[model samples]
Target chain A: MEKTTHVTSELNINNIKSFLEDIESFIFDCDGVLWRADEAVENAAQTIAFLREQGKKVIFLTNNSTKTRNDFLHKIKSFGIDCNIDEVFSSSYGAQVYLSKINFQQKLFMIGEKGLEEELRPLGLEIIKNFEKTNDGIDNVQHIEPDHSIGAVIIGMDTSYTYQKGVYAHKLLAENPNILFIATNTDPSYPVKNGKSLPGAGSIVTMIATSTGRKPNAIMGKPEQLLLDLILESHSLNRAKTCVVGDRMDTDILFGVRGNTKTLLVYTGVTKKEELPSFEYQPQYDTRTIGDLFTLFQKL
Target chain B: MEKTTHVTSELNINNIKSFLEDIESFIFDCDGVLWRADEAVENAAQTIAFLREQGKKVIFLTNNSTKTRNDFLHKIKSFGIDCNIDEVFSSSYGAQVYLSKINFQQKLFMIGEKGLEEELRPLGLEIIKNFEKTNDGIDNVQHIEPDHSIGAVIIGMDTSYTYQKGVYAHKLLAENPNILFIATNTDPSYPVKNGKSLPGAGSIVTMIATSTGRKPNAIMGKPEQLLLDLILESHSLNRAKTCVVGDRMDTDILFGVRGNTKTLLVYTGVTKKEELPSFEYQPQYDTRTIGDLFTLFQKL
Candidate 1:
């Protein structure tokens, strides 16, 4: 196929294995490289098992803010993949950490999924004006009251995203420029089953950005250094020895390149082989899929 | 006292009067200049009357997409300001004209106020899915359906702006790159009663822009030449003899400056006299308020 002819120049099984020899740690993106929805990638669980057997430390990093570290851990374990709760670094987990790092003790306004709220609320933060949580039969923006005590506004993917929320957030951010704006992830949309994708945290964040004319003070997802900082802080990760692997180039490969970590892009997720030429960042290695990496592992 | 001290350098009553001597046509911004909400600005109607009595043509121009030309005409008449329907130009009115100019004949999707819909629907265009119109008690995005018949997505300020509407628009635009995306205006917020402002059409427009990663094909409002083109085409407007009077420098003054017409900034609206030094665009004259310009009109 075209993919074989395309990647033949710079990538092959032998070259990929030789490149992995010096890499002591392997960072795997959960969504596309390991599993899509409930189904695991072909031979992906075996690939991680083989890597673990080879004394290579494996880490699961994701920009998905819908899930907390515990949620991701449970999902990873169900797939027969070995993962510790501490080994999982998700944007939702990073959000609470980021807030704690900044010492933001004031009330928090959340516009994300339940998992994001779950990870954040445990930080002992008071939730502001549950206007959204308590609908109160109010469909009008004027009826939607404002909470002056709100200090930071955090956003992720919410199935219950509404226009009323956008207006209220706009009013708060506009009136008080001192409010801390945080975006858990700016992925415009996340892919679902059957090739259909729904709006992501970025879609909600963008609505606020348009209304308030402000960007997030801190972005807690991949492509940003915050997640990598969290991953590196706990573990003695060497930029040269740790290889970052993911499906997307913009978020995964770029994150690695920016952090000086070796990156290997897999074909199991969002990006394609042909797209590698168009992107500003290039992965050190790419294969047919994450399953292909398992084949190299079997040879050794 | 602060404003008087601020304008002593490049603005004065004698200097302002001399600059207005050569102007034959006056283009006035409706909001903050002529009126604020239901109440007319102090002496704004008298200023227009004085200018009209002096044989000068006065036209009402506004970037507010929430109102149609006819609606503005009524509002202008309510304040005892003499104005023909043709003299009133709003962003919503310009939007229909822009669409017709491009010969766009297809089903449309909208995420704006009722006035924008009123101005646009009269063009005889078939509207796409009515998920918003017929809410059907469905709050979830997955339950929301898509319409393939959509050819263009127009945005204004929708009081009913919901996350569901934003998601559907994002889906249609993402699926079809050929779809026309238009923004009625980019005014961030409009000043409301008691010094408070609500999110404007631009907030809704920005949300879609973020969701789709695309800018509008045409922005029909102040500071853009489209409105001026429509104004010039309809009337015998000589750019050199025309002067645009308004309170906001970013929109009204910037619009006039770009159109090669003289600009006069007034203190009756959003901008302050002290802030004039920081802006890139400068008006030929600045006074305490629009009523100050009427003072020189009496000398004739």
Candidate 2:
């Protein structure tokens, strides 16, 4: 394996305070950074509080499309962290930002649950008056009629994902070739309750892409600059002062790098300590856990 | 897009006779060639009857893993074509063929319906006493406890496929990295009815593969010689004298090409005439429909 090309700096007491002082905004990725599954990461809540106390912009920018912005707020709040609805930015929220970008007028055919719908509905985007009521008794056998008004197909993490939903999305995309196809995020699987994981929207997005023989026209998640752009545009945070702390390198670190923001990698989630060199994108600073940052700020 | 590298010859009155004369065994893809979703092609039954009269050993080889060999036999028989149980080969059959190759002792964790199970159950391969009874009430949130007895996980097309199934498959493959991950076939979509298509086993297979971060150890379906190998070994058919006819290039034609059998492309299914020149794999003979062949053999 090729060695890491960039000089990967390990955060220490000597270099930590000075490097941290430059960062005004802290964009943390959830699931691994602040919490994993339902449990909050130890001292991670304290670290966020400490940053906020120091007048730093703490925004939870996540590629996980499973929850709405409000749901995300509740989860973080339950963890004893004070969070506003505005501070939460999910891949699901990217649909609103992306749809408004194209000035999309027609209805959207979605392959996601309430999280995706909740985010998009706020933008006055019609969701095509879909499933649950439509696909009541019959689950997979019910054939969804093609709605001519559908202009785009947006896919995100769906717990109730079925073959019927996939096939319908495939049919709509196939017939209406010009429709905007956008993927919320493409994280294969997110870390769940145990060491186990659930399939992420990326898996579903890729499955459709594989079958449809077409990739998303625009990816609305991290590493693609959409979610970060949502954060930047909404918060009006200076890119130079924004530091993205995340668990995965492909999404988190890469997202920060693409947005011209500083990146910090934590090891409590997907990306590990030794696996850092193997990744193409190197972070500016990396620590074993977010609690390590808590220790530094505690001493200060 | 670049033009086709090889000269793709169209089957005509002169070339068709010569091409038809060279082949002894006829391997037909059922979905597009013989039938399309419970309806038989216009003169496809007559074509099969005509070929059989000319002493051609007819075989229906399909990448569709949704049906067992017996189910396939019944479907063809229902279409007024003579077909033996041995002549019908499906991608699901590859599970039995592949298991016997590995001499797989432990139980299998399957992600398919009765057709896939029915095929493997006959092989005396224990199917881990799977779902329907277990995941009865809860659909997506069913927490399936892992069975350590599982030695492999095989997937095929399933209408009742859920997100829970995808997550479980991802979990199993993740925990048991050494498990034999065999995909029946990886055709993205298959035509069902009303010019629309259903998501193929390939989509589900690809979904799990994406989430698991691993590809199938062996793909049992078309383009891979496993299904064709099963047909060749069981029937003792000569590969050189065999001609494989189908609608799709990636699966059907590529399967024949890889198996060292003559490939004939028909436009009755997924592959179109104009799209043939763009495909990487070129067939030996191209016809508008299988009926064109019936016309040639009708005179004989």
Candidate 3:
């Protein structure tokens, strides 16, 4: 649990001023709000520019584990929004921070892509290929065995995943009760080519967690507070001033409500307009679309 | 919904005699009562033989979709039990029957292995690779597609599955609101080479069904009356003379309750002995073990 303390500028007037008066730093959800299914939202770049002119610091946050921060920054730039790599906060980075905090020492068995591994390596954790690597007397080719030395199991998206991996993870979890389980995100689906979607790492994490009866220690993405805490920590921003603005209520709005930050729901991404009135926790600001936020800001 | 018709047989003696006085046939759950995992229960063969000697027809019913009727028959024979292939009933067989009843024409996008597909082919249903295969120039692989042309979506055990398969299933389900969703079994776990496991086809079916908001048309496996109906249809066995004996309450005892047949719970498999007395629905005859049932029959 991290303390929330960011303060927004009182003199700033945005079009959504009536709803988001005290908001300063903006946290944007990448997948749906900023861009959707390989297409950037219309006027998305201009709106980001307008927010920057208003002296609001922006952070691109995403629960998607498939793409690294550098990859996301590149994609965001391609979408016509100028953003630095440091302004990106991914769930994978949060996972690394979480692992570092807990001081988990065992060889990591990652079920994710290279980005996830890159984040965890800074903590001096070695990634073991398989459970066979733990075996001491094995004369065979490079084998990853679970020798009761591994400290935690980390799961992320791996397209080449197999049933054997799940079985091995189950075995390791069953063998070591103290071992921690960490997941990057819990989004069930991710965008693919031609507007199609694929089952993300969340599905695999769900499978392993459900089977082992061991809930993950933490999910480092939006809807979870880990990434938000890391963002505030890195920028020395107070939580109250830093409002999370995005499209999806489950991730963006929930993150705001959980962190006690003002939330702005933009109807430009995954969430539909009709879904707002029924949300359990209402957002501080509700705009017809993200592009509308720019017009509202100008009026304010 | 199926009718629960109480069946009675003359084999019930003393305190249990009245319940069996009118039973003419016997239904037995294969997995637990007849066999544990892949091992046959001791004297289980003799008990079925004795029931046959008493002019009681036996139906070996199971919810496990990994094996077909012929496979079950051979396995039973190897355990020294004489069972006809026709006497065995599986959920896959029932799903095929359900599909045939509706005159399904389009190739089935089967999410199962060879056994499930083999069962469906005899029903004149064509088997498509996946929803991706239907991507002809006309279909266009868009966000929304029509699924009325699809005959059915049959799900079963698929160990060599990928995320793409799940995505395709999700796409097909989203496309056709009226497409039939059929699952082989609802067993959460299956016996693997190591031990009890998570995610058989039933688990996958559950995930897809939950996501799509569609209930399966019919589950033909154990605990469902469809398999029982098939057994009764094949053997011409009267409901009044049949009894279902097995270990698992949800599958075996519930099957008997649904079919209105006598249920004998043999404590030699999945269900533990301590769990019997507190069960909400009590089996007609509670044997200490499967061997005890044969000993009692031999004494009679």
Chain B TM-score (each prediction, in order): 0.90, 0.91, 0.85
DockQ of all predictions against the true structure, Cα-based:
0.34, 0.50, 0.16
Pairs that collide, model 2: none
Model 2 lDDT tens row, B148-245: 66788888887777777776677778878887788988888766567777677888999999888999998888888878877888889899999999
- C-alpha RMSD for every candidate: 5.1, 3.6, 6.2
**Looking at model 1 chain A, which ten-residue stretch has the lowest summed lDDT?**
A1-10
Candidate 3 stretches greater than 4 Å from native: A1-15, A18-20, A128-151, A173-179, A193-195, A209-214, B1-22, B130-149, B193-195, B210-215, B236-241, B258-260, B276-285
By TM-score rank, best first, the candidates go 2, 1, 3
Question: Considering every candidate listed, which one attains the maximal lDDT?
Answer: 2
Estimate the lDDT of model 1. Answer: 0.78
TM-score of each: 0.89, 0.89, 0.84
Arranged by DockQ, best first: 2, 1, 3
Query: Model 1 off-target regions past 4 Å?
Result: A1-11, A37-39, A77-79, A132-144, B1-13, B16-18, B37-39, B132-143
lDDT of 1 by residue, A109-154 (tens): 8887778888998789886524754341213464555787999888
lDDT of each: 0.78, 0.80, 0.69
Best DockQ goes to which candidate?
2
